[model samples]
Target: MKKMIAVMSGLAMIMTVSSTVYADFGFATEPDEVAAVVQAYIDEKLPGKAVIEISEAGEVIVKINKTSFLNPNQQVNILTENLRSYLLSNDADYSIVRVVYDEEATQPAEPTGPEEPAEPEEPAEPEEPAEPEEPTEPEKPAELVDPEKPEEPEKPTESTEPVEPENPAEPAKTIKPGDLDSSGTIDVTDLTEVSLALLGDRNLTDDQLKAADVDGDGTLSLADLAKLRQYLSKKIDSLD
Candidate 1:
């Protein structure tokens, strides 16, 4: 039964061949940095009847046949597990896998559409301006009085007694030292003048502010202020 031995040996050989081919390497995944290099290797080796899925999430799924016509174990260990390890070393975190079932090649769903940006709000219209205030009528002016009717000059006297020509009155210089502050008093306004003098602010308009600044050391300063205080103190004492 040399014939029986031959048949049995042949059967054993066939079964071993079948098991080598049909084993599985399981996962679903995406393309990563090493994706291109891995892909090139796979394309060169497996060629056809293989699928690669590269998800946007960076999951890499390499699906090969449960039955490769060529080196079958090579398809599982070296290609599948080594690829997973390479991706891990490069920074990919979680991943899943499954064998390529002879029945179906699962395709992940496509996203619907790009997200739309939000719109800006429209500005509200400004409220209309309020009505302008009404103007009031001015009061009537008082009638002018006749100076000729006063006792001082009811009429020109018919004087024949040598009405000597009256001398012309001199123009009045009304700016008094006390009037600098215009309070009709010689108090703080004069002191303020001294202060300005200390600051070199000598451009006084009324000449009143400058004149009250008696110490005229040219500029307004604490020196002038102190002088003013002393002058005022003396003046006040004299008033008693």
Candidate 2:
């Protein structure tokens, strides 16, 4: 009867410890009510060996503190599948339920030494500007002349004796009766001149008019032109 009492007492203690472990895990409750259901599921699979935490984005993180379960990786996968099925069955909004070992979660990052200081960069040299060219001086202006003191005029030389004026040219004398142009010949030119005079298209000189009056009436007319044409054609021997 004592053995039976101790066995029952021991079972009660195990139940109390399991309840304490589940309570100590403190599953997420404020941000998501579904977190309690997921925590309870993880507690049933891992018992007191796993902790449940919910991220701000409502992802379920199951950290296994003990690896005493056979095929821990397979167990994590099975637990993940079961939790995913439960969330799906309940139509919960949780998207991810990750299961990892405690060391993987709390492992310290490798220490990184300080980075070597970077070499100081040399400053670039400034370029010197080209020198400005000197300005050229302007040429001086010409001297101004005085208006009051004018220059003297040139002196005139002594005058010589007055020179005599040249005699006027002599008038041409009539060489012949038919030589009207004073060219020493009577030809078509004289005929043309006489014809132009008779037509009033030309003004003949005194010698030419005297010579052109072949009939000697002292006045030129068409009769003189006819007589002159007759003389030149040899029909009349004498122009007189």
Candidate 3:
């Protein structure tokens, strides 16, 4: 039993030592290992000025301390090309973290106090304006009168005086004595009608007989026809 216990103690010591050494061989923290890698890159690429810093705040932070970094533009160029190649080749998981300077350490901020609230000013009271007086209406002037009385309008004259009507002209007579055919004169036509009546060759109307009688005799004969011919020859002035 004593021999077995001694062997068991020796085995446990060797296991503890081996595990400790193995852990030591590995990275202390992933961030520290990344910082170390970044530092080597800075030294190789940047040379004398820039460096990488690793620290623990609430968590491990890898920051680029650019306190004496000579060329920021050159460092930026290296980060884009060489740094990206390094991370990709090494399979680093720092794609999301933006590498920038730890400026909060170099420049300390001044302490400030809470500012006092400003007092509000009271609004001024508005003044009341005076009421305007009503405007007075001007008095109307007396109606103008003409000194001379206007001429009295002329009264319309009534047609009281009796109107004298003009005499009417007599109508023209359609028949004449000795005008046998009522041809408007005692001529050969009247004689010819009387001759025709004597011979009974033509019938004579009462007005024709009246026209055929040239001497104002009631009867029509050869004597009346001769008188008509004489009148036509202008031997008698009037056949009235």
Deviation from native of the Cα of residue 40 in model 3, angstroms? 99
lDDT of 1 by residue, 156-207 (tens): 7787887788998988666654346566676776676656655777556646
Off by over 4 Å in 2: 1-172
By TM-score, the better pick of 1 and 2 is: 2
Q: Model 2, 79-103: lDDT tens per residue?
A: 6777778766655534556776674
Clash counts per candidate, in order, are 21, 0, 0
**Candidate 2: how large is its RMSD?**
29.9
- Over all chains combined, what TM-score does candidate 1 have? 0.22
| lDDT scores of the candidates, listed in order | 0.57, 0.74, 0.64
Ranking by lDDT: 2, 3, 1
TM-score of each: 0.22, 0.29, 0.27
Question: How good is model 2 by TM-score?
Answer: 0.29
Question: Candidate 3, 11: how far from true, in Å?
Answer: 99
Index of the highest-lDDT prediction: 2
The list of candidate 1 runs beyond 4 A from truth reads 1-170, 200-202, 215-223, 233-240
What would the C-alpha RMSD of candidate 3 be, to one decimal place?
Answer: 33.3
lDDT of 2: 0.74
Could you tell me which 10 consecutive residues in candidate 1 have the lowest summed lDDT?
A: 22-31
